[model samples]
Structure formats: structure tokens, C-alpha cells
Target: MKELAHLNKYFFKYKFYLFWGIVFTLISNLFGIVPAQVVRHALEMVKANIALYFLFENSSLQVSSYKIITFSIAVFGVLILAMAILKGIFLFAVRQTLIVMSRHIEYDLKNEIYAHYQTLPLSFYKKNSTGDLMARISEDVSKVRMYIGPSLMYLINMVILVFLVLSYMFSVNARLTWFVLIPMPILSLSIFLVSSIINKKSEKIQKSLSNLSTFVQEAFSGIRIIKSFAKEEKFVETFTKESENYRKESLSLTKVDALFSPAISFLIGLSTVICVYVGGQEIIAGKITAGNITEFIMYVFMLTWPLTALGWTSGQIQRAAASQKRINEFLKIRTDIISSENKNQDLQGKISFQNVSFTYPDTGIKALKNISFDIKEGESIAIIGSTGSGKSTIANLLFRMYDADEGKILFDDTDIKALNISNFRNQLAYVPQDVFLFSETIRNNIKFGINGVADSEIYESAKKAEIYNNIMDFEEGFDTKIGERGITLSGGQKQRISIARAIIRNPKILVLDDCLSAVDTNTENAILNNLREIMKDKTTFLISHRVSNARLADKIIVLDDGKIVEQGTHEELLATAGMYRDLYEKQSYSETVPS
Candidate 1:
């Protein structure tokens, strides 16, 4: 009930339409009662005329009096036809108003969910899969829409119908109404029991579906790796197993859902049998007219549809509750990263790690331990380390992707935690090792970091990153659409384009995390030369294992086992005859002796 109440805010947002929709539904239901009453009155009139004919069987005048019956029938016929037309009109209004409102509400809710996703921190995404989030947004949200729209509309109509029909039934024969209603309590109990089971089963079914979606998404995303490894059969078997589980869970829910309608129908059938038996005895006892019993039977049949629909509506409500719970689980989680209430302050190029130590969530090992370094404005520093030596972790901290587990990081001699996250990040640009490009034109990818950039700026940035010539070689040049993840371009081209994207912003601080590893040595040297010119007025952190690249920085830092072991100029490190010098010699030997 609490979940349902929370959902009503969406319905109430379009109260104008909902108000008119309810009014129209009430009018339509009122029209429905008229036709049944007209039929009863017409039957009563016929019974009386037949009796009069029998009393005066020999008189022609008596037979002439029956002509008035023809006019009476015609009047009732016209009333029924008019009522049917009015009912149709009101029904159309109800659908247009209420049903259309649901569609609008669905649009708003989808946007809200997506907007919330954009605000979530990287750690949230790390713990959740794309498929599970997609299922919640698309599949689960759609189920909630069903509950708000057709199910609620029909449920409200049923309530109105039962009330009006029951009132008339009691007016005609109170005793008979009591007998026919014997099954109502039992029907309600059955629906309540079955609906709870359906709710639980629906949750399991949604979860299984999310798992299946995740598997398919991962398979498609990693198709290249799977095909290269020749694991097609293995993947196919795994997908088949997941598909079977989804089917099994769905069928289990269906089994319980199918019981609702028939169980309600069986109870309704019993009410009909009792109505006919008791009402007939009343007629014979002269306690009621034949028309009264006839009307009572008709009302019982009129009650049949809403009673059965009640069962289905109950299941819909329960399924929506389960879906809401699933969606709220993610929506309710507060991100680990949030901005301080302090006023927005622009970051300068100066950066400092004051005894910073950090560990990733759910992992016991520290990625960075007591790391203290100062990077001055407009200076270039190279962070050299082997894999898992916390090189990227340093870049991540500068980018504010994660805060230090202990100690503080400063921007321009002020604690970075005091600045708004958006304003803090606005001063920096990053080119990560794993470059990702959208399936868009080359021009769009280059300009993705900033809004309202000019074509000349884009071209100049591409030229500086040494990718302009390669881009121009294509028939459409910058206008050509790159396939997913820039698959149409070579690794070297993708990395250079990514570089161009970063440089286009002309940030105060730049962090390049081994982004040049994919390019050839000659291209790497050319790009590095261009980068030095661009780095003249900006603070830069160059993360790489290539000594040739590190040699260009003013200062070099060597990391081993999450600790800084060496820090000096490139020449000073070599003079120490330490880890930096040994790594440089080994890399030089590998390059000279390579296949």
C-alpha cells in the first residue's frame, strides 16, 4: 500500500485529465444501468397486455387496444439506442483522457530515471551491469505504466459498476440480493491469496529476465574476443541455459495468474444458480412480480464481469508493487561521491597529494599508500610504473573519480573536497588508456568534451594531435560516421582522435594515462613533440612505462608496490643507477630485439 501511494504522485500530476476521465466513466456506467431497467419495464408491460387479451378473448376492441403496446416498444427501443450511443461517447472520452495521461507520465518517469543514472558515481556502475539497469528502466518501468493506465482505469470502473448494480438489486429484492452475494467474500479472499503469490513470482521472473539480458549484452559486447577464442559453442550453450531459466520462471508466474480468472468465475457461477432458485420461489409466493425476478437475474449477470476483472486487476497491482521495489533499490542508493556545500571555486593547475592513501571498495589491497607529491602549474611530470603499481590510481584521484581513503588532496593550496565536484573537474582533461568513441561522426567525437566549439578549433586540435591528415584521407573526412567504439578506425587513429578530444578543451591541467601505447614509435614521437608545445602553459601528468616518453617530462616519479621509490629529473634517475635506469635499459633491449 505504501508503494502504491507513492506511485499516485504520478497520477496526480495530470489531475485535470484524471478528473474528466472519472466523470466520463461515471456517466458511461450510469448509461449502462438504463438499458437493463428498460428491458425489465418492457417485459412487465408485455405481461400485462397478454393477460388483458386473455380476459377479453372474444372482443375485437380489446385487441385494438394492444396497438398502444407497439408505441411503447418503439419508445423503449429509441431510449436503448440513445443510451448506447451516449455510452460509446463517454467511453471514448475516458480513454482519451486517462489513457493518454498515462503515456505522458511514462515519458516523464523514463527521463527522470535516466537523469538519475547520469548523477550516479562510477562505483555504482562498477557494481551494477548495463543489462540489469536497462531491464529496470525499460521493462520494469513499462510494467508500472500498465498499472497506472489500463488496470487502474478498469478497476475504478468496476467499483462504480458494482455499487450502482448492487443498489438496484437490493431495491428490487433485498432477500435475493443477500443470497446472490454469498460468494462475494470468498471471491475477495481467493484474489487476495493468489495476488500475494503472484507478487513474489513476478519478482523472481523479473530477476531471471535481468540475468538473461545481462548475458546477452555481455556476449554481444565481447563478440570479437569470443570469436577469436573460438568459444561460439560454449557461449551458445550458456545463452540457452539462461533462456530456459527465464522461460521456467515466466511459466511459473503464469500458472498462478491463470488461476485468478477461473476461480472468480466459478464463484460467480454459484451466485447465478442461487439467484435463479431463490427468485423463482419468491415469484410463486406472490412476494414479487415476474418482472422483479427477471430484473434480479439480469443484475446478477451484470455483476459477473467486474467481479472477474477484480481478480485480474489485483494481480496487476501486485506485479506493479514488485517492479516498484526493484526500481527503487537503485534509485534510493546515495552515491559515495558528492559535492561539499561550500561555494563553487575554480581549480588552478596546481595539485598536491598530502599523504594520500586509498583503497578500492571491497578490495583489501591499497592502490596508493601514503603518496605525497606536488605538481606546480604549467609543469610536466611523468608517472612511470609497471601494471598494478598505482599509476592510474593517481590520475583517478586528480580527476576526482574517487576520494582518498585517508588524508587530503589539494587544488591550488585548498582542500579539493571543499570545492563543488563539477567546478573542480572543469579545470582538467583526461585521455585514458582504453579510449571509447561513440558511433558518431569524427567532428562530434572531437568536440564531445565541450559545448559550442567552432570548426576551426576542432581542426587545429586534430592537427596538434597529428590525426588531421589521417581524418582527411577518408571520403567524408570529419563528417564520416565511426562505427561502435570507433571500430572503423585503427588503434593508432582511435588513440590520436581521443587525444585531439582532450586537447580541444585546452584544460588548465591534463592527465594522459598511457594513451599513446597503441601508436607506432615514429607516430608516438611525432605526437609527443606536438604535445610538448601544447603543454607549455598547462600542468601535465604523463603516465607511461615507455622511458622515451618519460624522458620528455621535467620530473620523473617511479612507483613500485603502491609506493614512490624514486623521484628526479630523467638524467638524475639514470645517474642514480636505480630502478628507472634498469627499466630504461630493459625496454631499449626489447625494442631492438623485437620480431
Candidate 2:
């Protein structure tokens, strides 16, 4: 209910459009009831004609009676055409207003969700499935639109139309109105039961659809791995299973949804049969005129459609309500990275940690335990360890991707939590182990986030990363479009482009997470040399396992099982004859024995 109510803000903004829409609906209905009134008048006129003919069988003026009836019908026909036209015009206005309201809600919800997504820490994405997130943004939002534009409007119309139509009938004949409304309770009870079933089935259907999306996304993303292992048949079998499940659930939901309208309508139809039976008897018994019967029956039948709408509108509300619940769950996730209210402050390269500790939200064990370190401006450092030894965790902390569970990280002794996260991260540039490039030109990828950088700056950054020559060799040069994640480029080439992007930012701090593992030793050496020339003033944290990569850093640190075991210069560490020296010997020994 809270999530659905969030849309009320948008409705308030566009209330004037809604007001006019309702005004026109009233106008349309006013004209609509005109036909029902004319129907009653027609019955009166026909009865009068019958009496005149029966009583004055030989009257010469009977020709005038025929003329009077014909003229009355022609006038009714013109009035009906006019009513229909006005009704159509008002219907269009109502539909357009609903569309505008739906679109406004979509815009506001999309922006809110997207903005929330941006604020979430990296751990959130790691925990949540990408397929589920995409479903929220697309499928969930569309459900909200269905609720706002049609379901909600239908509800409003249902209330107004029922009240007004019932009031009119009651005024005409209280006894007859009581007979017509006999099925009203049965109709309400039926709709209530169906609506409960619809909510449960709709929730199941959405969950099934979410799984289907997950299967499709994962299957395509890992298609290469599946093919390499010859698992096409397995994937096909899996897809069939998921698709069949989705199909069954969707069919069940449709069946449940489809049963509602007819059930409501059946009860309403029962009332119609009674009206016809009772009304006919009354007229034949001379208790009421035929014109009165005609008016009452027309109004009684009019209640059927609105009653029927109540069922489907309930289902739509349930689906949208489920979607709204999902959306609110997403919005309610607290941003792990705390940001400052003032966001315009600049950052320098100096960073320090004091008695810092962190454990993932759901885990008892810590990723980084009681770790404390500091790096001055223009200092170069390397962090090396086995996989999952918390080497990258240090990089995560430096950028405040995840705040430390205990103590504080600081920028030159100022608490990192006190500074604006966006401004703080803007000061640092990181190139991760997995390189992600947009499906765009090499130049554009390098120039992302900032605009109007000169060609020379792009060339310089590419040259520093040792990718300039390869980019120039392409037929389209730097302008060539790189496929998604730079699929067109080799692994080594992709790493270099990622490097170029970081270097181009010319940030205060540079962090690389095993960025050069793909490139050959010769290219690695050249790239390192270029980085030395370009990164003189920039503070750097280099994460790697290879001794050659770590040797370039001014200071070296070794982590083992989330604890810092040793820290010193390369020569100092080698002289100490600790883990770094032993690891170096093992790597060097392997090089000589390799094929």
C-alpha cells in the first residue's frame, strides 16, 4: 500500500488534467443517459399511437399521427448521433489524461530507481542478480503503468457510475430497484474471492517470469563457456524446464484471471432475467405503464458492465501491487557507502586507515581484519597475495566502495565517511581485473565521463598504456567501434584500453587490480616504463601476483588470508628471506622449466 501510494505524488502534480477528464466523463454520461430517457419517451409515444388508432379506427386524420411518429424518430436519431460524438470526444480526452498520468509516474519511478541503483555500494550488485534488477526496471515499471492509467481510472469510474446509476433507478421505482440490486452482494463476494486468488497467482507468475529472465540472461552471457564444454543440450534442456514452468504458471494465472469477470457477470445477468420477468408481469397486470418498465430495465442492464469491470480491475491492482512491493524493496536498500551533504569538495591523493576491519553483511568472518596502512602523495605501493587473500579489498577500502566496520579511513586525517563519496571517488581512478568497455569507438571509451578532451590527450594516454600503435593500425584508427566489453580487441589489448581510460582521467590516485596479467613480459615492461614517466606525481596502489609487476612499486606489501604479513621495499623484502622471496623463486624457477 505504501509503495502504491508513492505514485500519488505524481497524480497530485497532474490533478488538473484528471479533474477535466472526470468533468468530461460526467458530460459523456449525462449524454449517455439521454438515450435511456429517450427510450422511455419512445415507449410512451408508441402506446399513445396504439390507443389513438384503436379508439378512432376510421378517423381521416390518422395520416397526421403517422407523420408525428416519424418526425419524433428522426429527432431522436439526430440527438443520439450528437450524444455519441460528444461521448467519443470525452472518451478520447479521458484516455489521453490517463496516458499522461502513467507516463509521468514512469518517469519519476525510473529516475528514482536508477538514482538509487547508482548510490548502492558494490556489495549490493554482487548480492543481487542482474536479471532480477533488469526485471524491476522494465517489467515492474510497466505493471505500475497498467495500474495508473487503466486500473485506477476504471476504479474511479466504477464508483461514480454505480452510485449515480443506482440513485437514478431508486428514484424511479424503489421497489423495482430493490429487485434489480438483489445480486449486488453476490457479485461483491465473488469479486473479493477472485481478487485474493489473483494476488497469489500474480505473485507466482511474476516470480516465474523473473526466473525465465535469469535463465535467458545467464545462458547468453555464458554461451561461449557452454559451447566450449559442449553443454548446448544441457542448456536447451534447462531452458525447456524453465520455459515449461513459466508456461504452466502463466496459464494458471490467466485461468484464474479469466474466471472472475464471467462470475460477476453471471450474477448480474441473473438480475436482468428477474427484471424482464417481473417487469413484464407488472405491465400485463396493469400495475405499471410499459414506459416505466422500459426505463427501469435499461438502467438495470447498465449495471452489468461496471460490475464486470470490478473483477479485472481487482486483478490489475493485485499485479501492480506486487510489482510495487518489489520496487519498494529495491528502493529501501540502504546505501553502504555514506556520502556527505556537501559534494563539491576536491580530493588529494593522501589516504590512511586506522584500526580498520570489515566483514560482509551476512558473513561472520572478516574480509579484511584489523588492517591499517597509509600512503602519502606520489607514493607507489604494491599489494600481492593468493586469490581471495583480500588484496583487492584494500583497493575497495581506499575508494570507499565499502566502509570499514570498525575505525575509520581518512583522506589526510579527515574521515572518509565525512567527505562526499562521489567527490572522493572522483579523485581516484581504478582499472579492475575484468575490463569493461562500452560498445563504442576506442576514442569515445577513453573519453567517457568527461567531454571535449582533445585528440592529442587521448593519443598520449594510449601511448602511455602501450596501445597507441595497435589502435592506429586499425583501418578506422581510434574511431573504430569496439564491440561490447571490447570483444573486438584481444585480452591484452582490452587491458591496455582500460589502462588508457584510467590514465586519461589524470586522477590524484591510480589503482590497478592485476591489469597487466594478459600482456606478454616485453609489452608489460614497456607499459610499466611508460607508466613510470606519466605517473610521477600520482599516488598509486598496484595489485598483482607476478614478482615482475610488484618489483616496480616503491613499497611492497604481502597479505595472507586477509592479514598483512609483511611490508617493505623489494630489496628489503628479498633480504628478509620471507614469503615474497620464496614466491619470487618459485615463479622464476617455473619460467625455466615451462614448455
Candidate 3:
């Protein structure tokens, strides 16, 4: 009942169409029973007075029995035809309306689900699988749509059909009707027991399908890696296992579903057999007319279908309920980007960190801790650290991917927690170490986040990043499709395009998070030179392992294990003989020398 009420609200928009469709279906069913009743009445009338009317001596006959029989035949024929036509029309109307409504439900679910994705934190993506989310929006949502459309109509039809047939059956023969009700209780019990098992099995199958989807998604995403390592057979073996599991689960479901209707039909047939045996005995004793028995049989046959369908509808209800539970669970996850009735301050990017600490939620290892720092507006600061020395964690904190537990991240000495996070992040842009590009044209990728950038501004930013000339050399230039993950671009080209994306944003706080790692030494130097002068008045945090990049900053902070251990300019840091200087010597000694 709760599920039905929930479904009613969910499908309320299409209820009017469904209501009219059901009305037409009911009318058709009402007329559809006329022929059997007419047959019983005609038989009884013909028996008593056929000879009197035929002899032409019964002047008292208001209407001839022959005329009555002929008229009944014509009326029955037209009524049967009208029933068929109305049934077809109602079926068509229901189908059309449900199709349209299903599309609307699917469209809204996909869009809203994805919109939820956009608001969820980075940790949410880390914890969940993209393929699972895709399957929910595509396959699971489709299951819900099926329930709203055909399954729902079938359910309603069964109810109306049962009510009509049962009412007629009870009116004609109360004892036989009571006997029929016996099988109904058994049928309901069977449905209840089997449906619980079916629901559990179906949910397991859906989860297994989600796992298979995850496997396929991962395989495609890492195709190049798999091929390079010659692990095609391993992946194929894994996929085969998942596919076999899926097939077995689906076949198990087929077994459950296939048994339902046949079992229902058997029980219903048993009831009818009992009814005929009892009613036949009564008719022989002259307890009821032949017409009542005839009409009763017709009603019994009609009632069988609705009883049988109860078993089928049980299966559908379980499947739909399982699907609804999955969707509801997804919707329950709270988004990390908070939007509440409470207000927050606007930001001006005078960033300060006080005793900040962060640990990955799953791993429980501190990625950053006691990381105290301050950056005045327009100050060019550099973070020099080894690979795992929490350089990127700084950038992540600034972006508010994971909020700190022990400290305050402030902008203009105001806690960022009190600010609108989206509005706060809008003033900053990051050029990450590993660049990610969409499968789109180079121009679109450059102008991605900032869509309002002019063509000239795009070209200027591209030139500054040292990739403009290379782009122009291509046949289609910036308009050429970058292929999957910008595969068409060389590593250095991809990096430079990423830099151009950051540059075009013209952010108040620009983070160069090892942005030069992919580029050649010459290209890196040129791009940094241009960027340093252009962003002189904008606060910049340069993060890198190489001394050359850090040497350009006004102040350099060297870190080890989430805490800064040294702070100085390039010469001062080298003179100090700290971890940064040692790392610099190792990297510097490996540089090229002209032969």
C-alpha cells in the first residue's frame, strides 16, 4: 500500500490520461460479458414459447421469439465489435501517454542525477564508480519508467477485471463464489513468499550488473595501459566471469517468472473445475436454471485471468520496489558542496592557513597537518617539496575538496567556511601536474571554463603557454578534435593547453601545481617567464620539485611530510643545505651539457 501510494504521487502528472484509459478499458470489459449472458437468456426463452410463436396462434405474444432471437444475435454482434474497438483505442491511448510520461521521467532523472554529481565532493567520486552511476541513470531509471508505464496499467486492469468478474460471480452463485475465494488466498500466499525471494535475487543481479559495468568502464579507460602490458587475456577472463554471472542470474530470474503464471492458471483451473462439478449437480436437482449455470461459467472463466495475473503482478511489484530502493539510496547521499539557509561572506583572496590538517577519509592517513601559511594578495610564493611532501594538498585545501578538521582557511582574514564556497573558488584557477582534457576540439578545451573569452584572447593565452605555433601547424588548427582525453596532443602539447586554460581565466589566485613537468626545459622556462610577469600583481603559488621553477618566486618554502622545514630564496635555500638543496643538486647534476 505504501509503495502504491508513493507510485501514485510519482506518476501523478500522467494520472488523468491513465484514468480515462482505465475507464475505456472498464467499459469494454462491461460490454464484453454481454454475449455469454445473452446466450443464457436466449436459450431459456426459446425453450418455453418457441412452438407457440411458430404456430402463429399466440396473439398474446407482444414480440415473436424468432424476432427476439434474431435481435439478440445482432445486438450481441455489434456489442462484441464495439468492445474490441474500444479495447484497441484504450490500449493505444495508454501506450502513447505512458511512452511520453516515461520519457519525461527518464529525462528528469538523468539530468537531476548528473546535477547531483556536479555538487558532490571529490571524495564522493573517489568512493563510488562512474559506471555504477551511469547504470543507475540509464538502466535502473529505465526499470522505474517501465513500472510507470505498462506495469502500472496492467496492475490497474487486473483490479478492475477482478472486481467486475467477482461481482457477477457472487450475484449468481454465492456458494461457488465462496469456493473460488479459497484458491485466491493460496495464490496470494504463494505470491508473497516467492516475491520476497525474487526481490532479493533481482537486487543481487542489479548489483552484479553494476560490477560488470564497472569492469567494462575500467577496461576501456585503461585500454592503452592493458595493451602496453599485454594483459588482454587477463581482462578477457575477468569479463567472461562477470558475463557468466550475469547470465546465470538472469536465467534464475526467468525461472522464477516463468513458473508464476502457470502455477496461477493451475490453481484457477482447479477452482473452476470445482465450481462446474458443484453447479452441475445443483442444476440437475432443479435448484437453479440452466441459464444461471451458463452465465456462472462465463464469469468463472473471466475471473481466472485476474487471479493468474496477480502472480505476474507480484513479480513486477518486487522488481519495481527493488529499483526504487536503489534510486532512493542514491538520492540520499548528502552533497559536499553545502547550500543552506545560512549565509556566508564574500571572498577577496587574502589567503591564510592556521593549523590546518587533512586526512583521506578512507585511508585515515594525514595528507596535510599543522600546515600554517599565509599569502598576501599579489605575493608570488613558491612551494618546493619532494613528490609526496603535500604540495598538491595545499592546492586541494584552497579548492575546498576536503575541509580541515583542526584549523581555519581564511580569505582576507575571514574563515572560508563562512563564505559561499563556489563564489570563493571562482576567484582562483589551478594548473594541475597531470592535465585532464576532454574529447573535444583544442579551441573548446582552451575556452572551457571561461566561455566568454574572445578568439584573440584565446590565441594570446595559447601563445603565452608556448603551444600556439604548434596548434597553427595542424590542418584544422585549434578546431581539430583532440580525440579521447586529448590523445591527439603530445604530452607537452596537452600540458601547454592546460596552462592556457588556467591563464585565460585571469584568476586572482593562480596555482601552478607542477604545471611544467611535461614540457621541455626550454618551453617550461619560456612559459613560466611570460606567466610570472603577467601575474605579477595576482597572488601565485608555484609548486614544483625542481629548483629552477621555485627560484623565480619571491619566497620559497620547502616542505617534508606535511610540514614546512625550510623557507628562503634560491641562494639562501642552497646555502642552508636542507632537503630542497639536496633534491635540487640531484636534479641539476642530471641536466644536459653541450657537446
Q: Candidate 2's residue-wise lDDT over 465-538, tens digit each?
A: 99999999999999999876687789999999999999999998899999999998799999999888767888
lDDT of each: 0.88, 0.83, 0.79
Assess candidate 1 and give its lDDT: 0.88
Tens-digit lDDT track for model 1 on 30-136? 99887888988998998878787667777986677577677788999999999999999999999999889888888887888898898887778878999999999
lDDT of 3 by residue, 1-595 (tens): 3443445654676666666767766765666566667767766776665675666655646356567756766776676677667767766765666556667766776777778777878888888898888878777777777676666666777788778877877787777678767777888888888988889887988898999999999998888889999999999999999999999998999888887888888887887787778788778887777777777777777776666667666777777777767766777788655634333554455788899888878677787878888888888789988888889988888888878768888778877666677777777888888789999899999988775779999999999999999999999999988877877778899989999998888888898899888888889889878987767778889999888898788788888888889887778888987887898888888785444
Best to worst by TM-score, what's the order? 1, 2, 3
Candidate 1 TM-score over all chains jointly: 0.96
Higher-TM-score candidate of 1 and 3: 1
Runs of candidate 3 with Cα error greater than 4 angstroms are 1-9, 12-28, 31-71, 285-294, 336-347, 593-595
Backbone clashes in model 3: 0
The stretch of ten residues in a row with the least summed lDDT in candidate 3 is 339-348
Every candidate's CA RMSD: 1.9, 1.9, 3.4
Model 3 whole-model lDDT (C-alpha atoms): 0.79
